[model samples]
Every structure is written in C-alpha cells, then in structure tokens.
Target chain A: MITLHDIGFSYGNNHVLHDITTDFHPGEIVGIIGPSGAGKTTLLRILLGELTPTQGRINNSSSANIAVGYVPQLDSGERTFPLTVEEMVLLGAAAFSRKKPWFDQSEKREASRILERLGILQLRNNRLSELSGGQFQRALIARALMSRPSLLLLDEPTSGIDLHTRQQVLDLVHELQTDGFTIILTTHDLNWVAAQLPRILCLNGTVTGDGAPSEVLTSQVVRETYGANMDVIFHQGRPVVVDSVNNGGNQ
Target chain B: MSYFTDPFQYDFFSRALIVSVLIGALAGAIGPFVLVRRMAYIGQGMSQSILGGVALGVVWGLDLYFGAAVAAGLSAALIYFVRNRGVPVDTAIGIVASTLFAIGVAVVSSSRDRRLNSANLLFGNVLGVDTEDIILVALVTVIAAIVLFRNYKTLLAVTHNSAVAAAHGVRARLMEVIFSALLAMVVVTALRVLGVLLVAATLLIPAATATMTFRTFRNITIASICLGTSFAIIGLFLSFHRNIASGPAIVLVGATVFAMNMLTSTTSQRNRA
Candidate 1:
C-alpha cells in the first residue's frame, strides 16, 4: 500500500497540486481522469519519485526498495530509434543490473517471457518502427513488465489507437489487474475510464472526486472536471457517458 | 598500382597514414553517440571554437593543441550550462560557436606572429604531422575507447531517453557531462588531421551513412568505423595523386560515400516496399 498525505506541489510560484491525500492498496486498478493541464502527468511524476511534493509526505507499506514501472507517453523520436522489440525490453532488465553490461541468459529469458505474456513474442525481433499502434503499446507494456514491478503506471496508453485496439488494451489491463498487480493509468477518455476502471480519480489540479466509477462520475462532477456538459446514463448495469454535443436523444 | 604503393615508400606518408587511420577510427566510434543524441552540431561548435584557443596559444607562445583543447572544453561546458538555463540547445550552440569563432578570427588578425599559420590550422596538412602528435592522438583514442566501452549501456540509455534513464537510477546528467568532455577531447585531437572546418564532417558523415544502411546500433557502429577508415585511406591516396589538400579530400570522400549509401538504401527500401 502507498499513501499520499496533504500533497502539494508548486513550480516556482505556480501551484499545481494542492492539499491532496490518497491511499492506494495492493491489487487496485485506478484511473486518473482529467482535462489538459489538470496535473495528471505531474501527479504521476511525483508518485514515481521524479518530483518531490513541497508540502506533503508519502508512506509506503511495502518493504524497502519497491520497484515502480512506468510507461511514458509515446514519443515520435522513439519510432526512429534503432532498437528491436527484444532489445527495447532488455533495456528494462539492464537498468537493474548496473554492474553487468551484458544481459545474461536469465535476463534474456525474462524478457522473452514478458513478451510472450504480452502476446507480442512474435514481434520480439521486429524493429520498433515496424510495429502498429496496438503492437507498439503492447511492446511498451512488455518493457515495463520486464522489471516485475510492484506498481505499474501508464500515461495515455490508448490515445492514438483505434476503438478496437483501445478495447483490446483495456482488456489486457483487466487481465493484469486480475493477476493482483497494482495499476494506475491516466487518460482523457472519460467513457472508457468509466466503463473499465474499478475506481476513478477525477482531477482538476486537485482530487475533485475519488470513488467507484458510478458514485464519482456524476454529471455535475464530470462538468466540474472537464468544463463541458456530459450526460451519464446506465446501460446493462454499467455507466456510459455521452458528450452533450453528440447526445442525439440522451438529453 | 604505383598510385597507392608509392606514397607508402616515404616515412612521412606512412606516419600520416597511420595517424589518419587512428583518428578516423576514433571519430567513427564516437559518431553514433553524437548523431543519436542530436549533438552533431555540438561537434561543429567545439571544433570551430578550437581556433580561438589555437590563436590564444600562439599569442602566448604555448602549445596550440593545449589552447585548442582548453577552448573546446570551455565552449562545450558553456553550451551545456546554457542549455540547463532553458535556452533551446541549437540556439545556445549557435550563439557560443559564432561568438568564439569571431574571437578567434579577431585574435589571429591582430597578432603580429608570423609563425602562426591560420590557414594550416583551418585546413590541416596531414603530411606535416609529427610523431609526438601521433602519440598524443593514440593516447587520447585509447582512453576514450575505454571510457565509452565501460559506460556503453548507461550511455545508450541516456542517449535513447534521458528521462526514462533517470527514473531507472542512471545519473543522466553526469553521463551527459562526461560525454561532452570526451567529445571536446575528440574534437581537439582530430584537429591535427581533419582541421577545424572539416572535423565535424568526419564525426557526422560516417555515422549518418551507417545509419542509412544498417538497422541495428551495433551494426551501424561497426559500419561507421569501416567507412571512416576507408574514406581516410582513399582520401589520402587521392590527395597524394591529385595534389589537393588532404583535409578537404578526406571530407569529400566521406561525403561521396554518404551520398552513395543514401542512394542504395533508398532504392533497397523502395524494393522492399
């Protein structure tokens, strides 16, 4: 379990996060939803220990030296980088073994296993530029899993993919959650987060709402966080969000 | 043919050949990092700045190589410092490079020393290389190879993505500084054969050509070394036969190879598609 208490962060004179307190238990799958400039990435960076809060403390119940895995946003430059999928995954293992410059057999085995688990083992020898959007996301996830991290944080995992690919990625996330791995992801897709994640944190520079999807994703809270009117409805016992502009008859 | 074998008969030609091979290999080895990290222009900046240092050394009756090394190191550090201040890297490099180059020109123009031949420094005369210069180049090359080999993985991580590397416990900033210093040393040592103007070409063209032809980092690096050395030898022979300046000949040979590689790779890619 990881707990953040009264977390506040300021860059120079501009405060980004303020007086936030939250606790994340093991095996929890949480989605952080917000508009642009909502400090979602900033919050993730702080949790990854890349940035320190100016006015808060964190408590971790896990043992010392907990490994945190992160899949950053896709960079266009990474497409041109001359690394095969296997080599990219091997970089994760390389980070742990600082003393050995070469990856041992066991490390290679681990990378292969992770690629297999991610259903991308066939692409292990393919260059990154050759992978499609969905395959590329899977490769990045495999790279993150190579560390066998206790906590996994993914930033915008389904941003540029098609709807079918998005659903497949969400299904993969569900499978990972079933394996008792704690996962936190940030996304702007409100409907997807509403339907997929067990818990949602609605953030607009601070934690505006935090609870189960049904309880926290009310029309008023969605409006407050996104600054746009959205209609929330229940279909087959699951909540679905429709944007006001696109809601033909839901209004 | 005697065209190539005749130059090998002279001791100076043999020595110059050896030095060219060594410098070419060093530049080739360091080229990938420069291209991968987008520091190709930094080589231009540091090499050009070496002129100011050379001029300063001449005015003070010091070893010109020493002055060039110090000046290049300072310029590299200044570029690093400016980048940290939120200035875009290319702008910082451009500002520092032009300023230092102007200073070097001013110093040369005002100096009354007759022995300091600016033309020789700008366009190198590889035939005039001495044994001491060859020794210095060899020592620097060995040291650079060892450092790069020892930190190969860390440096790769940093070059690919610095933020991710930092998150994984690698000291990206320290590696960057050390790499910059090493690059400065390379530029300074290479000035003897490639000269200030063309040194950046030696550092850039080989890696770029390799990148066009290869798909893996290791293969690209190996290809770069081979191409660099080949260009050096071919350029030496061409210069010896045609009575052209050695530095321009080497760079022209490299440019030719780059163009040829570009053409072949594009055609192959089209064929694959």
Candidate 2:
C-alpha cells in the first residue's frame, strides 16, 4: 500500500499541490480528474518516486519490493529511436534483468504475451514510429504490463485516443482490476469517470472532491475542479457532464 | 587489386588506414545517438573548440590528446554553466566555440618558434600518421567499444526517453556524462586523423544513413559501423589514388552514401504510400 501524507509540491514558487493526502488501496482503480496544471501528473510523478514531495512523505509500508509500471500521457513528438515494438516493451523488463546485455528467452515470451494481451502482438516487429495513435497507446500499455507491475500509473490514458480505443481501455482497466493489480489513472473524460470509475479524486491544486461520482460530483465541485461553467446531469442514474453554457440557453 | 594493395604495403598508409577504419567504426557506433539526441551541433562545437587546448599543448609541451580532452571537457562545462544562466544551447555553443577557436588562432599567430602547423590541425595529414597515432586511436576505439557494449541498452533506453529510462533505474545523467566523456576522447583521437573541420561528418553521417536503411536500432548500429568502416577504407583509397586530402575524401564518401540513402528511402516510402 502506498499513501501520500500532506504531499505538497512546488516549482520554485509556483505551488502546484497543497497538502494532497491520498492513498491507493490494493486491488482498486482510482480515476483522478482535473483541468490542465492541476498537478494530476505531478501527483503521479511523486508516487513513482520521480520527484520528492516538497512538503511531506510517501509511506510505502510494504516490506516487499513493489514493481511499479507507468504509462505516460504522451510520447514526445520527436522522432523516437528505431526500436521495434517488441524492443520497446522489453525495456519494461530491462531494469529487473541482472545487468544482462540481452533479453533471455523467457523475457521475450513474456513480452510477446503482453503484446498479445494488448492486441498488438502481430505488430511486434514494427518500428514505434509506424504505429497509429490507438496502436501506439496499446503498445505503451503493453510495455507497462511487461514489467508485471503490481501497481500501475497511467496519465491521461484517454487523451489523443479514439473512442473505440477508449472503450477498450475502459474494459482493459476493469480486467486488470479483476486481476488484483492496483491502478491509478488521470483523465479529462468525466463521462468515462461517471460510467466506470468507482472512485474519483477531483483536483484544483488540491483535493476538491473525492468519492463516488454521484456523491462527490456537483455543479459547484465541477466548476471548482475544472474552472469551467460545466454542470453535471444524471442520465439513467449516472452523471453525464454537459457544458451548461452551451445547453443553458435551451433550458 | 595491386593498386589497392600497394597503399597497404607502405607503413604510413597502413597506419593511416588503421586510424581511419577505427574512426569510421567509432563514429558509426556513436553518431546516431548524437544525431538522435540533436547534439550534432555540440559534436562539431566541441571538436572545433578543442583547437585552443591543442594549441596550448603545443606551446606547453603537453600531450596533444590530453590537452584536447581537457579543453573539450572544459568547453562543455562552460557551455553548460552559461546555458544554465538562461542562454540557449546554440548560443552557448556559438560563444564557447568562437572564443576557444579565436584563442587558438591567437596562440598560433603569437608564437615565433611554434611547432604547431595550422593546416595539419584543420585538414589533417594522413601521410604523417605514425605508429603512436595508430596506438592512440586503437586505444580510444577499444574503450569506446567496451563502454558501448556494457551500457548499450540503458543508453538506448535513455535515448528513447529519459523519463521512461529513469523508471527502469537507469540514471540518465550518469549515462550522459559517460557519453560526453567518451565523445571528448573520440574527438581527441580523431583530431589528427579527420581534423577539426570534419569530425562531425564521420560522427553523424554514417548513422544517419543507416537509420534510413535499417528499421531496428541494433541493425542500424551494425549497419552504421559497417558503413563507416567501408567509407573510411574507400575514402582513404580514393585519396591515395586521386591525390586528395584524406579527411575530405572520407567525409565525401560518407556524404555521398547519405545522399543516396535519402534519395532511395524517400522514393521507396513514396511508392509505398
């Protein structure tokens, strides 16, 4: 279990997070949503031990070494190295290999299995530059999964992806949660949050709302989290967020 | 065959041949990372900047490569320090390269009894390559090869994405420092073989050509070394027969190959489209 206690971070003076105390329970999926620069990615970075909190400590009470896997929201638009999709995925296991120069047979098989699970096994030998948007996203996920990580962090997994891919990601998240992997993700898709996420952590430099969609969501909280005039409406007992300004004139 | 084999029978040509081959292989092995990282300018800048160090070595009776290595290392540090204070990388490189090159020119012009030959430093003299020069290049090439082999994957991982590489416990900074140091050594070793004017040509063109021909990083690396070595051999032979400067001949060979690769790859890609 990993818990952040009073985790406040700042970039020299521009404070990003303020006392963000949260924890991820084992075998749970939590979706964090907020506007740009809401420290959603920053929070994930802190959790991954990429950055030390400027204020508090991250408590990982587990005595065992936790294999943490990460899928970034976007790859840099720069031309990536000419690594095959399989090689990119194999990088997930590179850290765990005992300083070996090459991936052994078992590791290669595991990579193939992860690629198959992500539905891009046939495209394994293709260069990363050749992958389409949805294919690239799936490859990123497959790479993360190659580490056999007990904890997974995906930043903006739904951004820049097709709706079909979005649904596939939703289904995959559900499947992974069932497999006892604790997952944390940040997204801008409120509809995805309402439809699937059991818990939502809303943020605007801090935790504005944290609970199930119905309990934590309100027009005030939505405005606070996103800094937009969007309003939430219940559709078939689930919250469907709509821009109130666009639909306000009709009502 | 005799015409080609005749050059190898001479001691100087053979020595120059060995140096150029190692330069090609080393440059090929390392060039793509430099280009992919967008450090081609840095490579050129550092190679030119080392002239000041080399000139100072000539004046003070120090080992040429030692002075070159020190100078390159210092220039990189100074540029980094300047860039950290809000200067752009290109601007920093420009400032450092010009200052050092001017200082080298000043040193060369001021000394009445100077042993330093400007043409040799700028254009290289392949016929002047001695056994010592061959030994120096061979030593550096072996070091570069061993380091590349030991940390190939991690270095490539960092090259892909440093943030992602960090997640795998690869220290990007450490790798960078190692790379820079090795590059400095490579440049120093190349100072007499390729000269300051053409180090980046060998350092980048081979790998750039390979990138178009190969789809995988490993194959690209292998291809780059082969291409670089071939270019060096052919370039040396061309220089021997055509009575041209070895450095320019080598770069011309590499440039020609790169141009041909670009032409074919683009046409093939367009055909596929």
Candidate 3:
C-alpha cells in the first residue's frame, strides 16, 4: 500500500498541495483527474521521490525495493537522436546492472520478451524518430514495464493518441493490474477515467473527493475541478463529461 | 625527400604523429556522448577555463597539465554546485569561466618578460611533443576508450533519459559525476597538442561533422575518429609547410569538413523528400 499522510508542498512561497491525506492500495488502478496546474504531476513526483513533500511522510510497500517505473509525457524523441525502438526499450533494464559492464544474455532475453509481449517485436529495429503517436505511447508503456516495478506512474499516457489506441493502452493497464501491478495515472480524459477506473480521486490542490467513480464524480466536484457550467452526462453506458461553455465539446 | 625516407626517422615527428592519432581517437570515441548529453557547451566552457590554470602554472613554474586539470575540475564542480544551488548552469559557466579566462589574458599580456610563452600555449607547437608525454596521452586515451566501450549501453541509457535510468536502478547522479570527471580528463590530455583555445574543437567539430552524415551511433563514432585524425595530420603538415599556427590550421580544416558534410546531408535529405 502507498499512503500519504498530511502531505504538503510549496514552491518558494506558493503552496501547491496542502495537507493531502490519502491511501493508494495495491491491485487497483487509481485515476487522478484535475484541471491544468492542479498539482497532479506534483503528486506523482512526490510518490516517485523526484520531489519531497514539505511537511509529511509517505509509506510505500515494505518489500517494494525496485524503483517506480515512470512514463513521462515528454520524451527525447522531440530532439534529434537516431535511437531504435529496441534500443529505447533496453533503457528500461539499464538500471539492472551493478558493475562489470555489459548486459548478459538473460537481461537481453527479458528485454526482447517485453517487446514481444507489447506486440512490437516487428518494430524492434525501427528508429524511435519514426514511430507514430499511438505506437510511441505503447512503446513508452512497454519501456516502463521493463523494470517490473510494483507501482507504475504515468503522466498523460494518452494525451495525443487517437481514441481507439487510448482504449487499448488503458486495457493494457488493466491487464497489468490483473498481474498485480498498481497503476497510478493522471489523464485529461475524465470520461475514460470514470468508465474504466474503479477508484477516482478528484483533485484541486488537495483531494476534493475520493470513492468509486460514480459516487465521487458529482456535479459540484466536476465543476470545481474543471471549470464552471460543465455538465456530467451518462450516455451510451458511459459517463461523458461535457463543457457546455465550449459549445458541446470536451475542450 | 630524405625526411620522407622513414616517417619515424625523426623521433619528434613520430611522437607528434602518434600522439595526434591517439588524441584524435580519444576525442572521436568519447565525443558523441558529449554531443548527445548536451554537454558540448559545457565542454567549451571547461576548455576555456583551462587557460586560466595554464597561465597560473606557467607563472608559478608548476606542471601545466596538472594545473589545467585542476582548473577544469574545479570549474566543472562549480558549474554543478551552482546548478544545485538553483542557478542556471550556462549562466554560472558564463560568469565564472569568462572572468577566469579574462584574468588569464590579462596575466599573459602583462608578463611578457617573465620568459613565459603564451603564443606557444595558444597555437600549440606539436614539434615539442616528447616521448614521455606522447606515451602518457596514449595510455590515458586507451584506458578511457576501453571504459567507454565496455559501458556503452549504460551510458546511453543515462544520456537518453536520466529519470527512466534512475527508475530502472541506475545511479544517474553518480554516473553523471563520473562522466564529468572523465570529460575533464579527456580535455586536459587533448590540450597537449590542440592547446587550450582549440582543444574543444578537437572534441566537438569531428563528432558534429560525422553526425551530419551518419544515422547510427557506432558509425558516427568511427567517422568522427577518422575525420579528427585526418584533420590533425593534414593540419600538422599545413602548419609545417606554410609556417602557420597548428591550432588555427587544424580548426579551419575541421570547420571546412563539417560545412561540407552539412551541405551534402541537407541536399541529400531534400532530394529524398
């Protein structure tokens, strides 16, 4: 279990997260939904130990020794580097070495296995500069899973992908959950989060509400986290978040 | 023609040639990491900072390479410390290195009568390379190259993504510190022939030139080494024949080769498109 007790964070003088008390249990995919600049990334960073809380403690699983795998939204692909997909995925196992250089045969086998599992073994030799948005997202997730960490923290894994691939990525997360991995993700797709995630954390600086998606995604919480005049509609057996101010669109 | 009878007939020229090749190999092999890590600017900054150390060592009658190494190390540490202190690294490098470099210029200008030759340090008289120094350069370069080749994948991971590397259990910060130290070592050794002002070019130009044409990491490294060594040999010849400065001549040749590579790659890319 991951527990944050009285967690507070500040940048210089601006208090970003104030007294956040929450518990994230294992074998569950928890989705954090919030507006921009609402400390979602900061909360992830705190859990990943990139940023320490100013006034609280975090309790992780006692036996969880491996570092938390992170899927950053931004990648070095935006820069010009002729790295291949297999090369990129191999980076996930880079930390598995202690000394004496080079990865042995077993490590190489494990990396190839991950590539096969992700259904991208055919694209192993393809350069990362050539992958499509959805393909890149899948590759990033595969890279994250290479470490076999207990907790997977993703930051907007579906930000720029098409809807179909987004569902596939979420399905992949659910499958990993079935394999007993805990996924803590932040996404702008609240409807998908509402539909797929068992537990939802509505956040604005602090946790506004926390429960099952149907119970916590109330009209007041939606408007407070998102903007004003937002409507929550249940259509086609799914909760669709509509911002009427934006003229019947999610934006 | 008698001088061409046997290339190693003159021990000085042989030492210079061997040292140049070894230094070129060193720079070529390690340079892509510098290019990829976005530490090219910092390498330039550190090389310039070596001028101050060289000047001080000359004035005090101390070992020049030792002085240069210390100064470069201190400058690198200072850059990291300033960054850790919330100051931007480039700004700190600009402030600290430029001030120190300026001080070196002032000292060199005022102490013309102290029997210290600043021009020799700037342009580099490769004819003065002795057997001991050449052997030292070769040994250091070989060792460094071996380490780099052995740990190529781990270092690549660190360069690609420090966060992911750290997550996968790589000691990212420790690896970074080791990289910086090795860079300082490489720069100091390279300054033996290229001199303080032009050493960074020895490291950067050939790697960048190869990058314009090559897509694979391994091929880029090999091409850079070949180009760097070729430039050094040609530059040495041009300096000897025309009685010009070796350092400037080498850099000019490197710059020309780089421009040509850039032109060919751009035109080829356009044609493909």
Best DockQ among the predictions, by candidate number = 2
Return the top candidate by TM-score: 2
* Overall lDDT per candidate, in order of appearance: 0.84, 0.85, 0.78
**Candidate 1 structure quality by residue, lDDT tens digits, A37-128:** 88899999998888999998989997676577778887778767887788777776556664544667888899999899889999988888
User: Which residue pairs overlap in candidate 2's backbone?
Assistant: none
TM-score of each: 0.93, 0.94, 0.89
Model 3 lDDT tens row, B135-162: 7887788788777766666777787877
Ranking by TM-score: 2, 1, 3
**How many clashing pairs per prediction, in order?**
0, 0, 0
Candidate 1, residue A193: lDDT: 90
Q: What lDDT score goes with residue A93 in model 2? A: 71
DockQ of each: 0.46, 0.52, 0.49
User: Which lDDT tens digits does candidate 1 get at residues B119-231?
Assistant: 76777777668898889888998898788777767777778777666666667788887788778877888777778888889988999999887777767778888988899
Give the lDDT of residue B266 in candidate 2.
Answer: 89
lDDT of 1: 0.84
TM-score of chain A of each: 0.94, 0.93, 0.91
For model 2, what is the error of residue A236's alpha carbon versus the real structure, in angstroms, after optimal superposition? Answer: 1.7
lDDT (Cα, tens digit) per residue for candidate 3, span A12-100: 89888987999988778899989888899999888888788998998876765535888888564433566677767767877665444
Determine which window of 10 residues in candidate 2 chain B has minimal summed lDDT: B111-120
lDDT of 2 by residue, B1-273 (tens): 788888877788989999999988999889878878889999999998999998998799898888898899889999999999999999999999889988888897887644577877877778778888898889889988888887887777777777776765667788888889878877888888788878988989998999888887888888998999999999999988898888899999989989998998889999999
